[model samples]
Target: MVSYGLEEKTALMTSLTDKLASTENSLIESTGRLDRIKEAFHRSEARYHSLEEMERNLEGYQEGVKSILLSKGGDTSPLAGIHGIVADFLDIITPAPNIPNRDNIEGELQAEKVIEAVLGERLQNIVVEGQEDTKKAIEFLKSNCAGRTTFIPKRPRPEKYRIEGKALQQLSNISGVIGPAMTFIEFREGYEALAEYFFSDVVIVDKLETALNLLKETNSSYTFVTIDGEVVESSGRITGGISNGKSPGLIQKRRELRALKNELLRLEREVSGTEGEVERAKNEKVLLQVQIENINKQIHEETIRIVNIDKDIEALIDDEKRIQLRIETLCLEERGIDSEISNLSSELNIYNEEIQRLLAEQAEGEQEIQGLIESQKLGRERWEEAQRGITTRKLELATRKEKRESLSVRLKELGERIESATTLTTDKEESLSKIDQKIDGYLREKSGIESTITDLWQKKDAISKEIVAKENERAGREERQRLSEEELKEKRRVMEDIKKEINQFEIQKAEIRLETGHLKETIYTTYQINLEEEIKNLNLKDLNIDELTSSLTALKERLNRMGPVNLASIEEYQELNQRYEFLTSQESDLTQACETLHKTISKINMTTREMFLNTFNIINEKFQYLFQLFFQGGESKLVLTDENNVLDSGIEIFAQPPGKKVSQLALLSGGEKALTAISLIFATFLARPTPFCVLDEIDAPLDEVNTERFINSVKDMTGFSQFIIITHNKRTMEA
Candidate 1:
């Protein structure tokens, strides 16, 4: 048994004391929780009153709404225009009732008739000029001045007089042929016919003889025969005073009078018919006007009734709208109350759950308390038992301590006896000195061995480094050889391709040469010389043959470099190799350049992206602010960013003012988002002006201020660019 000192005993007491404190604190916390549970049961009366009031209001309102809605009858009225009231009612009716459909055919026809009556006649008139010759209509006389100038009343120049009289009769007959008559006059004597003809025609010699006589008597070089108002004929050769004849006959004037009378009669008939038609149209129009007035009066009365019906309908609709609003409001209120009730129920559930949890906790706490009481009673008994055990240990410790004191005294005497033995101490000290010297020599030898090992390690490292360098050099040389071999292989491939191409070209050239009879030899010689020169220029010996052969031998161990010979000859092979090397070098340079350019472009794009975004954001925000300033509250967006292709990547401005949800720009009224969006867009245009801006009807949707804003934006833009805005807006035009 080991004895515990006072210090150990004190530590055990402090540990027990700490455990007691922790247990007591747990018990106190449990007691406090029970107290809080007791307090909650006393404060739940106020919540019930509020819920009761809300429930009562909701009930009363619901009843009031149902009573009001059930107290109206349906209204009846006829609707006009393209559709009817009955159709609208049919659309509204849920379950169709057994009723006959109304017939409105006559009403539709009447409406059509009214429209037609209002629009007058659709008649058209056209005038065409008359083609008939009116020469016979104006009175003019003609007479022979050959011998009639001095023949007072003696012989009267009877022959010429008869000829002139007959000619006048023919002219009169021709006037009858002017309109509605088939009058033809072949002169009784051919002389008169030829004399009266307007155009030249063959006639008998009598007319020529008379013409000569007249010419002789009158002593005139030419003569003209006048019929009515027309000069019907002219003798190319005539003479004397008959050239200027007068008072040829009385028939010409009478023929003119007859033609005038016929035309006048025709005009009188036309005027009478026109007058009758005018009178008929006037009477019809008047009757239609009277009918229209009567119908208008009836329509006015009907319209008044309809307007009253419409007002009633409007009132009914308003009532319905208000009722619907009220009902909806009531429903909302009920729903709100129900939600509140639900929330209360959730709260009550929470409370119930809390109470149940508290009760469970209380029950568990009571059980724990009962257990603690039992444990405390048991622990107290155990602690008292331990106190008894400690008293027993103390008795045992007293006995053990007495034994230890006696042993210590004996040990002190032995230590003094050992200190008095001097000879043995001197021997041990000498031996210890020798051992220390041996240890020092051994340490020095170890130090020398360590230096040798370090030197060896340095030498080994140098050898290892040299070996590694040699290996690396060898590997690099091997890799170069391999690369050279690959170049040879690639060159051979290109040579093969060129050989195939040249072969094909030669085949084509041969065919062409065969067709060229005289030029074949010349063409072939030129092509052969070109091939020979190309073959001669290839320096096959300049390449590192041994290194290439060694690499090829090594490569053969892994893979076959030359599987088959597709090329024709070594010349083609060498030429193809040179071409391949040139192409490969060019390809590598291009690839590297492309990579560098791609990186540079990517960096530039990254830098410009931030700048573009910043500009876009600035423009987007400014435009939106300006749009809102004009529109009060709506949204606008950058339909396009600062990208060059605006139309391809155009963004749309979506404007929906506060409380509105639809995004359709068209659905907004003329005064709403249109002007705002237009102003914003124009402002954006001003920010980045181009060569020319063409605006078509952009200002057609704006008010004065918004229009002014747009125009000012345009004017501002015009400081740099040409602008052509097509607009019907007066303010835009004026601006």
Candidate 2:
């Protein structure tokens, strides 16, 4: 019965052990699933946060649109008139409730690139309530000096392009034609005009080939956009290609954000369910463990009971052996008594009483022996039964031992699994800790970089202000120099006029001297008299000859008829000539100073241009090299908008990645732009190495291959420049 009980208990324990193992496995699996779900949820949550930040910052919107949206307060606010961006108002069309698959058209329509290609920059066009609102918004944008933005008034305007009636029907009948692009979008009431303005004359097709065929067959002016974002314009120009991992458009970002949010919710629910399952399994495991322990205890008690039975059987066997020995001694003594009775027959009369007593004792002895034999037989039977019981117990014990060993082995396996799980958990925790440390370090570095950038911006502003002030000073000096030059020219002209007057006076004086000399010679020859002595001798009171007096009077009258003449005219002419000479020297000095100033300015400008061009050439060379290195095969160059006016001209970058046409930097896709910018930056660094360079997610848009190139480039520059890179990419972290 005990063996049976032990068997039952063993079976129960084995079942419990199995249950525990299964529960343990279930718990482990559930825990692992929960962890996975949690990881997914965290990733989704992070994505949602990033998208939310982008939306909040109005990252991809035009500057004017963002300005208007952000300008929600104050008297000059255009927020009242603003109706948000076109992308915000429009939604991708979903299938009807009854249609199950709907040919998977909804997914194709939801491709942001398709809509983006169809609308182009129009997606960022600010929608307004009316023309008045647009005007107000424009005025606000202008007042704020915000960048330009296109506005679409919600009020209907005259349709510029439309496919109607037969044309529309014919186009719709074409194979692979989805419909007008407008049909793939949904918008609120009163936004139809805005939608039609962008979507009119635009058709969506499944393939570029279909769009091309439609365009060729119709021979009409229409814009066709393939679902893959290829655009065939009315002018027969085709623009299509895969972009270099550019960030999704705002519409796509919104859609992705929504999807991530849904995914996060689903994961959260799944995590909760998994946790609950784990909890249930844990509870079952605990219950099974308790039952298993209780079964073990019962099995232990049964084993102890079997052992005690074995001890009692051993004691009974020992007692039977002793009793058999005593029986043997009594039988020998009875035989001796029989021999003595035959020899002492003569003495039988005398010992009659003694014989009767001996018989009585013998009878008692025989009865006792019979009782002993019966007891021995009972003991033997009992021993035999104990032996059978012991055999059965031994088998049961062996079975129990086997069960215990199996349970022990299973428990040991569970322990090993638990230890492995613990080790894994420790590793995961260590990894998490390391990641956290890295994050903290990155955050600190980011903060430092931001602070540095802020300081640099402040310094830039200060430098710009100083430059403006210097420019203003230069302009003021130029104006003063111009006025001084004009004054010097006037002074030079006056000096020239004085010189001409002096020359005329000298000529007149010479002519008058010659005439006077001729008169004196004629007087001396005709009258043989000295004119000077006569003039000294003659006076008004003592007049000499009447004819001479008359001539003198006529000469005096002629001189009086002319302008007044001073006897100090020679002295005055000498003084005026001295002043003219001084003025002439001053004019020469002023002219020389003006020439020197011009030369200085020319030298400065030449030096500035030489320095700028030198730096530009070096950077451009490095840029070309780095561009090729980054892109594997590409050409890029830096161009001055006006090389003649290099100092004031804008720099334009023309980049042609491998197998691509040369395009302006702005026209490149996001990843391409990032790579291009990195090339430019590294080129500059090579040209003028700085102490340190700070890059904030510069590799975010780059793919793995390009990121590797970028890291390598950075490593190459590590000899001279220290790099502070802030990124979340695992590859970047590893590097």
Candidate 1 lDDT over residue span 475-494, tens digit each:
67546645654564465467
List candidate 2 stretches off by more than 4 Å: 74-78, 95-110, 325-348, 351-735
Where's the lowest-lDDT run of ten residues in candidate 2?
96-105
| Model 1: residues with Cα > 4 Å off, grouped in runs | 1-573, 597-601, 604-608, 632-652, 657-667, 670-673
Q: What is the lDDT of residue 673 in candidate 2?
A: 93
Cand. 1 TM to true fold: 0.21
Give per-candidate clash totals: 12, 0
True-structure RMSD for candidate 1: 55.7
All predictions: root-mean-square deviation over Cα? 55.7, 37.0
